[model samples]
Target: MINDKVLSIILGGGQGSRLYPLTEARSKPAVPIAGKYRLVDIPISNCINSDIKRMFVLTQFNSASLNKHISNTFHFSFFSSAFVDVLAAEQTISSDKWFQGTADAVRQSMHHFLAHDFEYALILSGDQLYQMDFNQMIKKHEEANAEISIATYPVNAKDATSFGILKTNEENVITSFIEKPKADLLPDWTSEVSEEMKGEGRNYLASMGIYIFNRDLLIKLMDNPDTVDFGKEIIPQSIHEHKTVSFQYEGYWTDIGNIDSFFEANLGLTDDIPKFNLYDQKQRIYTHARILPTSKISGTTLNKAVIGDGCIIHAAKIERSVIGIRSRIGKESVVINTYMMGSDNYESLAEIDKKKINILMGIGERCHIKNAIIDRNCRIGDDVKINGGKHLEDKETDTYCIKEGIVVIKKGAVIPKGTII
Candidate 1:
């Protein structure tokens, strides 16, 4: 069981501008993944698997969908003290603006956290995909008597430029840090990981944006009104004054920051041996349990595809794709290398006929779509062709868009018949 000494705070990113259109309507964490689960489920499921009870998610942009998902999905028994609640950015007499940064977001919501009883405040990023047992990290924190402990993963020289890299002594005490440093600017000092980590070709310790701080030390750190971000301001300053240390995690961790990364991560799940496993019964990812019929397929061919529940596939060819719930594909259509976020509700035969449209809520017959993202509630007409590879740079229109060679049919978009791009 998770001890009462720890309380968790998940930082749902501000605005999520990097993950555009996907974050267009919902917050970053609320963006759905793996065909059924939202991005937030990764962190929350990790906490639940670790037996942690009390957790708060802080979000500032487009939080209505996120709030509704959390409220409808997670419910603790009346007898239990556990709760997963959202603390949105609100203006009070003391604070007038929205969350300026990660640190500021937590600082603004300190009142809600202070009301609860806990010793250490565990901070985590909501957009990351990974599974970890926090009890182990907390145990290390107490053993080292560290005022602050940051969870770290080793990264190679090529990938090191995109993360917050740090130098530590042999004892794992952090000495210096650099945020998104150039290769030449990296610190000379190097910390050693276990033999297991060395096998993975990891050379530098990259911060996972996960931290554990003593309750009092956290409040004191946030006391300064000027320090807004942790990686940019607070962490660099804390190395000298606080007993800061690193807890090494040599596991699969992916930061779903932008559209390219998000697309690749989702498609990676279709690999023969995926790095991140969603089938582990001991530590399974949880989400809203929607009641729907089993997926029905007739004369369809699928290869390396993960299809969700309540889908009707009719003589379609789907390869290397992740199809979401309530999806419908008509005869002879081909979907290749796509991430199809399916419809919210299924349309009946009567409703489909009444509309008299070429497509009804899903892909139409004889359509050829490749390397694209079909957002929810899309009506792709028959004979429509969308090839992200054709338009490599970027193009945006009311009907469709191409970002980084990935065609994104906007949410609720209606593509007419014989449309080609």
Candidate 2:
């Protein structure tokens, strides 16, 4: 068991521009995932499982939703030393500007870190999905007696260009680090191995953006003028100065920054032997369990789907999809390869087309939705057809065309029924 002398700082400030309609009203961390839980829940759950109770979530863009979610979901006893809080942007003695980068965000929140007496600071991204025993990483950091420890993973060289790759010796001491190196510059890890082991391989370890920094060392590094980001600036610069170590993680970790990646991550949940299992009794992934009854999936043919609690699926053909909590799918609706969230109700008489539907939903019983992302609480009218094949210019709304031609119904907007787009 690891001691509780570490503070986990979650970076939840990204704009999540890639998510578009889903992120328009909320920060990236606040965005819903796996139908029931939000993206930020993953890291928080990991912290709880790892027995690290003292945590802070830093936020900036569309932080209201993120703040509200954190407040409602994470409510630990204040009498105890353990607590979780959301730290928003504030005017500091140093600057009044918004966070310039990941390092800058931590630099601005330095006062919070200084107030607490912690030995190490574990910085994590709020948008990634993974199941990790950070206690192991912490123990490694302590054993290595290093100023910094980063969680690294081996990926193929072709995919290495998208990550901050690192070079380390047999002792796991990082010698060099590069961000998104070209294919030609990528190192062949198998080259050093014997000919018997020198088959076709593209294994190169890359940083997973999960860092455990010695408290004093982190403060000193942040004080430097050149340190801008942990990946782009800090780690690369520190390799020449500090004893930064790398901890290899063979477990599952995914960055859900884009739509395709987000879709794939959700699909992973349905796997029989999924890498990230939320249902493990020993390592239960904790979320704010809704006080609702089990899903009422009557008259629905659900195949290879993940249905959350309190969902009422009536006469709907939901195949290979994920339905969130308290969402009602009405009669004769066909939902395929899609994800639907809570606080939504489909009309009983609505006929939904499966092939054209992506992330579509209705706000309430009378709302009609198709081939579009209806934001939270959007009251779409009955018989409303948001039909425009995957890439139509919406100059009127000043929104870029979706590749799949998805029509987005903004949250809380009352779209009249029978209205065709």
Candidate 3:
């Protein structure tokens, strides 16, 4: 039913500094999510469900893992013209600089758009988790026949200052936009909605950072040497001169930019009425389904938790936590409200004694830990108690300090036996 040719370009190149230890080795987009899936899976799955097959993932910072994951998980047949490809920074005829911003990333990958002969370019962030029928947005874009179309969502006025808010006219035409406005300077939007909806008290419609651009306009905008970014520069300029339409989106959308948000987003999955459904049969979430055996949960006391495949919960007490694939919980070990990721060959053994049972907690096999986030592939010896979360001090470190006074282990770090960090 849609006629406009669209090319989906995902900006997956951010360093994700906000996620620190998790982003130490892997790119933000490649960071694991919901115990089994990666951050990029959210946007890719959204595109798949929306029937947008052609995709180009732009990567720069620590892209090897991301590229491998994309190649292994997303595969298209030769018969199909649509394909998903990873676009890395390369020496081009124009310039030899790395991507400076979102617009610059697109500008660098102009060749991909030119090759596809797309009429519209759909730009999205790879780190956001949401479910949207972009085809519907594309249809609305075509109906409006505007130079640009942005997906907008209503946020409380109190939270509006955190996002790029836009003011639209009665015809859904964007009149102005402000990025992270002060509370006192926030624009009012009561006139745009119906009288009954006015009492909502001027809710600000903020940009979800999802954009649909006329391919020609995008090319023109990118060609302008002065334009640096879509939100910071190009969008503001467009609203001033060009006709831009706003497509209001009413759905679950969350940008998992930090550890707290990431943890909260993962916890959102276990809700009785989850906002994001990974098990939608009609809109299946495609991943590299590991060829591991079913999980063996014997004599385990799990309460309100999520356990992955090939895991063995041997008489362990887990509550309100997410256990990664191939992880093993030793006998009588307690895990609560944590995110654990491990390989398929992970193993653990707990040592029990007459007086007090020694808990051998760790991420990978042979790694002993406790009250700490044992990074991937760490080796810990028996009788070692890593007090990663015990000492509660706001030391200048690049890791999340949980309110429970738990220490966070950075990725790819090693902890020696009997070491208490």
Candidate 1 C-alpha lDDT tens digits along 1-421? 5468989999999899888788888999999898999999999999999888799999989999999999999998988889899999999988999999999999999999999899999999999999898989999999999999999999877788999998889788999998888878654634687777667667789999999999999999989989989888989999999999999998889999998889889988999888889999988999998999999998889999999999998847899999999998989999899999888897878886888755688898999999998888999988989888744778889877777888888888999989997
lDDT of 1 at 48: 92
Index of the highest-TM-score prediction: 1
TM-score for each of the candidates: 0.97, 0.86, 0.87
The deviation in Å at residue 16 for candidate 1 is 1.0
List ranges where model 2 is wrong by over 4 Å: 188-202, 344-374, 379-410, 413-421
TM-score quality measure for candidate 3 = 0.87
RMSD of each: 1.5, 5.5, 4.9
RMSD of 1: 1.5
Query: lDDT values of the candidates?
Result: 0.90, 0.74, 0.73
* Regions more than 4 Å wrong, model 1: 187-189, 353-358
